[model samples]
Target chain A: MTALASDTRASRQPISFALLAQVILIANSFIMLYPVVVMVLSAFKTTGEIFDHPFALPDFTQVGNFTKVLGETEMPTYFMNSILVTGTSVILILVLGTMAGYAVARYESRTNTFILLFFLAGLMLPLKLAVIPLFILLRDLGLLDSRWSLIVTYTAIGLPSAVFIMAGFLRTLPLELEDAARIDGASEPRIMWSVMLPLARPPMAIAAIQNAVPIWNDFFFPLVFIQTDERKTLPQGLTTFMGEYTTDWGMLFAGLTIAAAPITLLYIVLSRQFIQGMTAGAVK
Target chain B: MLVSHKQAPSLKRQLWVAFLVVPPIAFMSLFVVYPILSAFAYAFYDWQGLARGEFVGLKNFREVLFGATMAPVVWNAFLHNVYALIALMVIQNGGGFVLAWLLYKEPFGFRFHRIAVFVPVVLSTIIVGFLWKLFLNPNFGIVNQALYALGLDSWAKPWLGDSSTALGALILANAWHFIGFPTLVYLAGMQRIPPEIIEAARLDGTNEWQLLKNIVWPLVAPSTTILFTLLFIGAFNWFEIPYVMVGLDGSPFGSTDVLGLVFYRTAFGNQSASIQNFGLGSALATLLFLFIVVFASMLTLWLRRREIQF
Candidate 1:
């Protein structure tokens, strides 16, 4: 009887341990998400109601807050600019990063290490270090106040990491596939395009998401380079709603919702891919 | 698909590669490299954007280091960064590691927890700053409300308004924003650990805690090194969180004025001011670059020495 009871106690310990872990995880996750949830709920409330019932759900769902955000702010224009900048940047990064990765991976000259090191140096130079110079150069080129400024900046910024990922991916690809393409009298660029680029869809998708999210969320570039309200991106535009009326939590939250909704929605729909891509970079 | 450059592209193909590559390189050099170089040159010339002064070699460096006012401000910012780094490493990374470890076990309904924790990471830092600004409001903020409910109303101070706690408060918020990335990274690292190793330890009568301390941790050291180094570098060069939360001047006695914020403030001079002191700004930028390089080198050396290969 004593032996049996001891055995049961030992068996119950793992189950209890797992239960403890579950409780901790659930609690941590709730706390992590509580602020955002409050923001979302506040977006549906009036300014008075948001403060009146701080922890409660909005008394009623109101699309009015979002409408107010859209009407009062330059959100639509910012959204379009974000889309244009992020799209162009990602496309350029995909093409150039792939080509650079191909060259670095395939070529084994004294220049290979130097080229890789050149790109790697960027990872060390924080954006602030270059912010001053970039501003002046952009102004000189008449590129300030345009979405193209951000596009070019984002491309340069995104290149090093994109190349890093693509290089790792390209190295993993089998040599035989390219060999056959070469044997068929396909030119080098043709082989890269027809043979390797398609095979690189996984890493490309990863790089695209990794590049797009931050570019979409960037405020500093638009804050400095973009001088006018009409050229503002979502993040930069959201700050317009913050001048002393930060107490009007409802409208502010609504603006935040407008700014954050797309990314959050995409995160929900494609979380597995998001997690996969993020983890791939971390693990590598 | 490795190939030699000797299997070189034809002239037309070379032209295509050149077309694709040269534009980006030129763009990078023009926007990134030129500005940096110009900033360096500006450091020597004592110009105030209008009248160009003769080159005063190392004068700016001497002023930046020994000048009473800016020197103290720079030192204070550096100290704040260190405080932020310690807080983030302990609170954010440590909490994240625990969560990742829990999720790795994959208890029933673990997927929901993983997704929820990571959700805030995708949101913009601006949004995060604004969100926390509201939540920490002493009057109607939920934090204060919760404190009042618990009869601890005295404890609920104006979080962002107070200089001493303002930087700390933003540190927590910044940690919240970035915690997910490190969590996911650690989780991924933990996943790569061979399951049989755990099974072997378990069969040897090892408890879960013992198994973790002995078998799991040593192998995850590489990820830890990467996480520690990256977070250190990120925290050392911190800007956006404090900038958006505390404003450009690092307000309420300038408690949160990290090097990046100071540099930005000098360059652009905020909305209230019109002075664009390009010389001082570039000098600040140069100082910031030097600071980061020195800090990163020391950190990398420390981390690399400890990085264990399993």
Candidate 2:
């Protein structure tokens, strides 16, 4: 169905007008990329140089800011904490959400519909609204300043969407596989663990990426629950860095770059996966 | 024995279901449900530090909604959130549609444009906020610097410093950060349109505008429903951007104040005042949550029904 009508009309438009549209897109891409590039460049310049020529190409050899940020600050510690917390949260979310999603998708229980809706409700109402009691509850439990505070909160926050994505995906898998496994004398848990779970890798990755990014980037939970310096994640820790070096432009930009680098690099490499993961919910 | 053989697996399935859903359900009940429920409970009590002092009934809710001191600030913050919501829906989502339409028509640089538009979206909100804050700095920021360079010096003012332009500046920064989300959503929607339908429309001598309006816009409804629901929630829960850029006080005389900031300041008082009042904060949180859930669900249902009609 090659559409001659639409193509002819598209071609009939003036070439210059079409060129203008292309240029606008290119210009937009430039605009989107430009600010971040300038920030990276500013990270290489001294405070004085930044004030003088903010846009000039900086000498790449001046790695002083990076060394100072990495050495003097707890940025590395924050990165480690972020990784640990985000990893644990994503794993928990994937496990719990998958089990629940599988149940809703495959099982013929009377409560499946209600159970699926229960998880779906979490998607609409944000967890931040519960901060008042959450703070009190965390402090009472003596988990206020621990990494577990973030881990638990994040798992709870992420479970709904993870469940949604998984259930939607699992329903599309043929029931014959499960039936075959059952006929082969595979135990219920064994079937799920061996056959279904492995096949669920794509949605699991989507769930992992979706949850990991937010947990890694979360500042509010750390700001609320984790009061100690050792427990702060990158986003909150970056704020601490900013507050400490208010006058040092190069160092601040360096800190920003450090905070942004991991995800940006990961995204650049796995951009298709990232896009698919984030917009997964919308499509479904 | 034969009946038992058939019943055994059914019983086993029940156990499996319990194992699968119980822990996650319990986990959610403990963390998400408990806190939300406790928020409602706390709304009725008075607090001293972390401890509940007395049962205050509707006092806290009254103070949050209608008190002489808190009412004005709360409403003001509420209005700012609404303004941001409307601005973002119009600017960010609207711009996204235009971009998606352009890309759908012109295949040149399709791959690059798709990836590039979404780059900022996946970045940390904290980074986006800090980057924009730095960009909008009065003297040395690139925004003003670029304006000056382009001989638009008269247009460059202290964007965040001036109260009048402060909220608008934050909204623009937000739009810049998230415009790609709607772009991707709308693009996906536009791509799903069958080419034959478009061809049939074109054969009738319909122009691009008519095609977009009559054909594309209506079909983008599903995306619209999702994006609208998300934007509404994001706007109302808008915290990180204003908090990072303008600071907790919503400074420059509180022009950028939002409900989240007010709730934060109220729940756990800031540097200026340290008198924490959990009661009033819970009341405020309860009201905000209820408002969001009720209205957003209604809006979604309405949009969904409209989608069916379209």
Candidate 3:
């Protein structure tokens, strides 16, 4: 009886330790969520109310701040521009990257290895340093101040990682599928498109999400390359808008909330895939 | 009778491979490789925006490194970047490792904790910057409010306004935004450890602390190396946070200035300087590039030597 009692006590110790860990994690998560939650909530409050009752729940009837942000500002145009740029860049990266990744993964040669290393070297090249010459190059090409410049630059920047991820993923798929497809008289492109591309979807999604977030949120390139207010992406627009409306706390909060909404909603909806995709690149 | 088989790929397959590979290579080389090389070339020339100036050999470099007026700003920004590196290494990565270990134990609500922790990472840094700017507002900010509510009113101050606390505040905000990245990476590393080895260690009378210190940490060295390399590179390239939270000048007496901001301000003048200096900017950019390359290589080599093969 004493032995059984001791066994139960020993088991209870670990359970208690786990429970303590749970408490710590929950508290830390609250700290993580606090600022974001406050931002979202403050979007609905008047500036005076925000200053008066910063922590209290606002009366739900006042959503004029959000309306003002969307209706009065150029936010909707910025949103469209962001969507267009990010979507187009992501598509270009995935298509070109998958093609290159497939070639490198399928062909085993010294040249292919060299090509792989070339792309991998880009992972650490500090491309931000190239901004000056890139400016010159774009100007020389008459591509300055165009959204196409951002799209093209984003695609170039995103390609290395996308190719890296796609190549790693393609190498894992069994070779027999390709062989079988080849034996069935399917061309190499046909095999790649019909057989391999389908298998490559998960990694494609991972690479897309990984690259898409940065492209959508990128402010540096837009700040440098974009000249006009109408062409500004969300981050640049928000920065400019905030500069003009720095004292209008309610509108600033609403503007921030609008800027963060799409990606936040996507993250909440696909948090699992998002986490898995991000961690997948890190682990390998 | 054995059928004759061609081992090497046919000409059609070669064309197909070229078709697959050529476009990305061309695009990357044209945009990425060419621009970087040209930037290096431009560092030596005394060119302003579009006009080709005299070929001044290493004059721009000398001025950027040793000139009377610009050198102090350059050195100050470099030191701030070094501080960012140390702070992130100690606070962000260190905290991430601890949280990863806790999450690895699969405590109650681990899934929720995992998802919630990474929430800030997905948001734009501009938004994160603005959010924190509001939260650290002196009059109506929640940080000061909470401090006062807890009777620690003396501890609260204007976080972004004061020079002494500005860089530290920016570092804290950066760490908060990125802690999720290292946590998830380290958690993945910890999950890769074989369970039976842990069981065997436990049976051999090792305490949890001992196991973690001896077995778990060594196995997670890959994740550590990755995090360190990334943090090191990111430190040198720090810009958006300071640019948004402060300004291009890295305001409040330039306490929060970073190398990236220095380069930006030099290239595209702000309140301080109205005229753009392209040659000096290229020199600064080249210096940044070289610093990242050399330091990252050395760090990777050192960290790679420490990785234990299990």
lDDT of 2 by residue, B1-310 (tens): 1122224347768898899989999999888888988889999999998889889899999998999999999999999999999999999989899888878875688889888989889888899999998889899888998899899999999999999999999999888888888998899888888888888998997777898898888888888999899898899999999999999989888899999999999998998998889999999999998999899989999998757332
For residues B1-310, what per-residue lDDT tens digits would candidate 1 score against the true structure?
A: 5544456666765665565456645655665567667778877767676455789878776666677766787778878888888999898888778778888889888889889888988888888988887788878888898999899978999988998789889988898888888888888888888889878888898988887777777777767777887787778778778888888888779887787787777677777876776667678778877776787788777767765665
Order of all candidates by DockQ, from best down to worst?
A: 3, 2, 1
| Candidate 1 residue-wise lDDT, A1-284, digit = tens | 99999899889989999999988887878888888788888888988887777777775557787887678667788788878888999998888787777777754445568667867866556665777667767777789888888888888888878888888888888777877776677887788878888888988999888888888888888888887877778788778767735666787888887788899999999998877765554576
Q: Write the per-residue lDDT of candidate 2 for residues A1-284, one digit (tens) a residue.
A: 36997686578764755777798789888978888899899999999998889889999999999999999899999999999999999999999999899988877677888887788777766889898778887888888899999999999999999998899888898877877887778888888889888899999999998888778888888988887898899999888888899888899899999889999999999999988888887865
| DockQ of candidate 2 relative to the true structure | 0.58
**Which of the two, 1 or 2, has more lDDT?**
2
Isolated chain A TM-score, each model: 0.89, 0.93, 0.91
Residue B245 lDDT, candidate 3, scale 0-100? 87
| Candidate 3: stretches off by over 4 Å | A1-16, A108-110, B1-6
What's the TM-score of each model vs. the native?
0.92, 0.95, 0.95
| Candidate 3 lDDT, B127-236, residue by residue in tens | 98888888888878899988988999899999899998999999999988999999999999999889898889989977678988999988899999989998999999
